[model samples]
Target chain A: MKLKQLFKLVLINIYHNKMRTFLTTLGVIVGTATIFLVVAIGKGGEAQVNEQYSKLNVGTIIIMPAQRGKVIDPLTKKDAELFQKSKNIAAAFPILNGSGDIKYNNYSDKSSYLGIMPQYQEASNLNLLGGRFLTEEDEKKKARNAVVGFELANVLTDGSPEDILEKTIDINRRKFEVVGVLKRMGDSGSRQSVDDSAFIPYSSAERYLLGTRANPVINAQATGLETVKGAIQDITNILNENHRLGGAEQFRIMDAGSRLASAQETARTMSLLLLSVAVVVLVVSGIGIMNVMFVTVKERTKEIGTLKAIGAKKKEILGQFLAESVVISLVGGILGVILGFANLPVLKYFQLPALPSLSGVLLGLFFSVTTGIFFGFYPAWQAAELNPIDALRYE
Target chain B: MGKESKCIIDARNIVKIYQNGAEELKVLDDVSVKVMKNDFIAILGPSGSGKSTLMNVLGCLDLPTSGQYFLDGIDILTAKEDQLAEIRNKKIGFVFQKFNLLPRLNAVQNVMLPLLYRGVEEEEAVRIAKEKLKMLGLGDRLNHRPNELSGGQQQRVAIARAIVGNPPLILADEPTGNLDSKSSMEAIKIFKELNQARNTIVLITHDTEVAEQMKRVVYIKDGRLFQN
Candidate 1:
């Protein structure tokens, strides 16, 4: 028989028994839809991770005092300068982090501050809202020049970037000139959030505001992503040599590469777990299809006999039942694709990320159809192997 | 030579045995029969007489335990299952007692089954089926499902289905068993007209009146055949 005619016959049979077909296909629909949704959610999580880490360079490494050790020798400007001389290291800077009160005329606000080198602006991806960043000349001359963050500028001057530019603010008890206001950068999976902090030259911070009370760390950049490990090794050699503590390491280095890798691994593991769930659902639904197909064969025993008596071969009868199951799953798969996409807006409304991929839809369809074929074969075979005399005589 | 050449069915010493663990029931015991082309014959038997088993063997639906049976010169015992199906498709037509019309299909589609199985194009099959149904006086009820049609109409549709493929032989099992007297008479008249048109037919029934109407009658009792 022509394939089209066979499908038409199968369709007519399915159409006449609408309730049974729908009930049999419901499990497939849910399974396919679950697969699609899982892929979309997985894609969304990957996108979110990429976006969160977008501002931080992968080669950037943070060096700090290890929490487990009491440091007799702290990271200093001289240590940073020595590390910058290495071939693998692109740039290195010493940073002193401290909290203090700032006074601008009568308005006062408190925030954490970072005393950093001139390269910190570029390395940290801090964009100046107005005016200019602290230059090498300011650092060399120990000029009390400060750069305030966006929110800090608003709190101090209650004005725009132009009004906050060049305003002198008192840090602790020393007067400092604000050279620039930084643009806003929201918090993410980074070592520090600089949104409301203040930046100043290290010389001025140590001399005027935080003398002898500073906690300093070194931040280093590698020339390329692949060179980060070499740069870390070089920095470790330089620091251990300078400290001269007989091989007892007192510092810890955290690289953005490991952080990014861990985050991506988390996302992949979550996707895999959900994918397993989808597979379980598909397998269960496949068993449901098998059960239903067996019942269908039993119910249509006389019909099979009648078809045989009218000269339908075993292959033709098998093809008919198999095509019926495949068509049912195909229909369910298409409906599932639509259902998955339709839930995208709902996911967005609930603040969940979803990115429906074409590959996801194709996989869903492939799995559902394969399930139909795999589960549908046994029952169709049973129908084909039925003896015509016995079937016709069956009540 | 001409008489042997015209034989459509030639069965000799056919035996069919059913086994139930240690017990064996011989359903057909040393039965033999022959049917010629264009010959109208009836195998008449009461219940448990095994006429249905004989019909099953004659129609190539069930193989005899031991026999040399030939239909249209094709060896029924030697043929494979698929070959028998193909032979049935090309050389035999069947009408069942219950009219056996698929309840979901309309009259025309039901009649189109045999032709469709012959790999005839759907349009040609439908055209032949419509001609057959129209000849059977179901011209206006082409779209009616079996449930919507009366018993006589359904049987007429079944008859149309049986002859649509223009097979050499028609094997009907109790074709009038579920019909009323008026419908049964009409069915017999249609069979007579079919035989007059040179179509061979073999009907199985218990009704003596129906068997008397045939050109030849064979009685089956206790799994044995007797011709009168």
Candidate 2:
């Protein structure tokens, strides 16, 4: 028979009973739609993380200090200078974190501050709203000048950005000049929220604020993103050589790339888990298709018999039923994929990272069609194997 | 009439037995018959008389338990399933009492089915189906479904379908059994007209009146054949 005629015959049968076909296809639709949504959202999440990489500086690495037995990790000025000397390393600085009560007239607030070199501004993507950032001269002379955060500015003057500039506030019982007020970076809270903190010269924190031996964290920047791992390697070797505490390397180095990689891996695992659940649903739906097809065969026994009497071979009957099953799933798959992408715009309105991918659509189509063929075969075979004489005799 | 009178179906000692648990029910016991081209023959039998069984054997729908049966010179009893299907497609057309039309297809589409099954192109199949339907006086009802047609019209449509592919033989089972007297006569008139075109036809029924209309008559009683 001509392929087109076969298709027409199959379509006629399907159209003759619309409700049964639609109900059978619904299971596949739900399963494939869920798959589409999950993959799109996963891709969107990865895109979002990549977008944040620009602000977070993917090449930057931080060496945190903690007591590893009798000795603590030392991020000294000399160590920073040695780190900067490396060919792959761009700039390195020491971070001295301390909290002190700062008093401005009648209002006094306890605030956290990071003592750093002048390189903190560019490395942190800090927006200086007013006044100059602390210069090298401030660190050299141990000047008591501070870079106030946006939140601290609100705490100090109860006014705009300009009100907090050039204002002096007492820190740890010593007077300090507010040299800069940073603009608020609201969404980058995960990147060590700089809004509520302050920055001061490292020399002032080491000499006056923390008179005791303060173990500071070392922050290093790679010249470019490609050199990050190399920069980390060179810095680790240099730090181990400098610390010289026997065989134990005293510092732990972490980078945005590693964190991002682990985050991506977790997302992938979650998406796969969700996709597996959807696959299970699809399998159930495939079974549902099988059941419906079996019932359809039973209902159409006389028709099959008539077709045979009119010269249809067993395989032709099988092909017709199988085509019906495939058409059901294919239609459901297309609709499910559309439904998956359809939810994306709504999700995006709520700030969800959701994107439709070509691979995801193709996979959905492949899976649905495979499910159709796999589940539809046995029932169609059963129909084909029926003795035409008996089928015709069936009431 | 030499070429037109060639044998269309020849069956000898065709025995078909059905197994019911340990009991063997002989549905067709040693039945034998020969039908020639342009022969308008009827097989008359009451319920359980094995006339349907005989029809099945002649139509190549079932293989005899043991016997030789040939349709249009092909040995159907020895033919494989697919070969039987091809032979049936090329040599035989069937009309059922129920009109057996696919309810979703209109009259023209249903009539075009056999030609379509024969791999005829769509336009050619439609043309042939239309010509046959017009001859059967269903030209105005080409797009009407089976349910939309009256009993006689539906039977006419079935006749049109059976002859549309130009198969040499038409095997009809109780063709007018569901119709009123007038529709039954109309359907019988169609059978006579088709037989006039030199197409061999075998009609199965329990009605002696319907049997009398055919040019020849055969009877099945208790799975055995008697001819006149």
Candidate 3:
């Protein structure tokens, strides 16, 4: 039979039972919508992380003290010395971290203070706006030199990076000379901005503030991208040897690449799990299509006999039923794509990533259509194999 | 009738048996009949007389359990189910007692169905269907659906569909069964007119008067056929 005629017949049947077609297609719609929406969210989050990490160095690795309840000694001068001597390591800075209220003349606010050596200004990619950074002699004599981030400069000097230099700031009730101000990066309108942080000499911080603190972290730099893996091995081996650790778990070398890779893997597994749930919903929807088709065949028994008697072959009848299901799925899938795309705004409003692409639309349609065909087969076959005589006799 | 006329329907010792769970019923017992082109005949029987079963076999909607049957000289007893459909499309047209006009399709579209199944172009099928409906005095009702037409008009629409393709044989099961007496006579008159136009028609009915009006009547009773 001609495809046009078959389509016409299928159209008439669908028109005859509008509600059944809609009801059968609803499950697929929900499944497609859920899957596409979740994937978009996952993509958006990954994009956000990538944008944030782009400014920093990929060769930078952050090593914090272990949380294994063994009182893993804080990274100290001795540890920094070991790092400077380690192979594949170009620079190392032991970060003494503290958070306290700072008073600069009449301006006072809470700030994060990171104490490091003068090499940390270059090794940690700290871009300064003006003035000199902390020097090695300052750390030896324990001079209270301070460098403020853009957020701190804005608070203390009314947003002028240069005005904050040569000023005095009291940190945790101790006076410090403002030596420099860090450049602005990822600080505007974000709570997790590094621009709000303060920096002082590591020896000075250990002498007067945050003495014998636990969970101290160290920031290490590799020579270049090429020696990153070797640098990581050296850090792990050197830290293990200096701290007399037996296991590799005492200090982790969390590099930019490994961090991003782990985040991506976690997102992938989470989205896949959600997608599987959507697939399960789609499978149930497929069963719904099959059940509806079975009922449709039974209800149209006399109509099937009429068609067969009027010269329609078995295959033609089968084609008509199968086409009906495919049409249902196609409509549902299109609606699902629209629904998912429309929900992207809601995802974005919540600060989530919404990366709904054209490929996602195509995949949604493909899955829905395949589901229709695969589940509609047995019912279509049953319609084709029906005995015309018995069908005609059915009341 | 001898070989002077071309035989369109020939059944020799046709048998049809239905299998119940524990019992087998013989629906058509050695039924045999012969029909030629332009023949207007009726298979007259009471309820349970196996006339419908014989109609199914002769219509090629079924195969005989044990017998030789030929439709338009194609040995249907050996034909595959799909092949029977091909023969039915080209050689046979069927009209049911219920009129069986697809309620969704209007008059012209209903008559175009048989041709459409044969892959006829849409425009040509519609043109041919329109002409046939016009011939049946349904020119103004071409766009009227089955539900919009009266019982007689629906039956006429069904008759138009059956003969629109100009098949060699038309098998109608109680074509006037749902019509009033006046509509019944009108339907029978149309059949007579079709016969005059060289259309072979087989009417199945229990009405004796309907049987008497036909050129020949084959009476079926107790799963057997008797020529009358």
Best by lDDT: 1
TM-score of each: 0.86, 0.81, 0.86
lDDT of 2: 0.85
lDDT of 3: 0.85
Where model 2 places Cα greater than 4 Å from the true spot, the runs are: A49-60, A64-92, A96-115, A121-135, A141-189, A192-216, A221-253, A345-352
In model 2, pairs of residues that clash are none
lDDT of 3 by residue, A209-261 (tens): 88766346777777787888988888877777767644446666688777777
lDDT of each: 0.88, 0.85, 0.85
C-alpha displacement of A236 in model 3, angstroms? 5.1
Task: Looking at model 3 chain B, report the run of 10 residues with the lowest lDDT sum.
Answer: B1-10
Q: Considering chain A alone, what is the TM-score of candidate 3?
A: 0.80
In the range B6-115, model 2's lDDT, one tens digit per residue, is 98888999899999999999999898899998899999999899988888888888888999988888888779998888777778888888888877899999888877
Fnat of candidates, each listed: 0.67, 0.69, 0.73
What digit string (tens of lDDT, one per residue) describes model 2 on residues A19-58? Answer: 8888888989988888888878788878777766667877
For candidate 1, write residues A294-361 as lDDT tens digits. Answer: 98899889989988988999999999999888888888888888888888899899967688999889
Candidate with maximal DockQ: 1
Which portions of model 1 show Cα errors greater than 4 Å?
A45-56, A65-79, A85-88, A95-116, A124-133, A138-217, A223-227, A234-252, A346-353, B1-5
RMSD vs true structure, all candidates: 4.2, 5.2, 4.0
Q: Could you tell me the C-alpha RMSD of candidate 2 in Å? A: 5.2
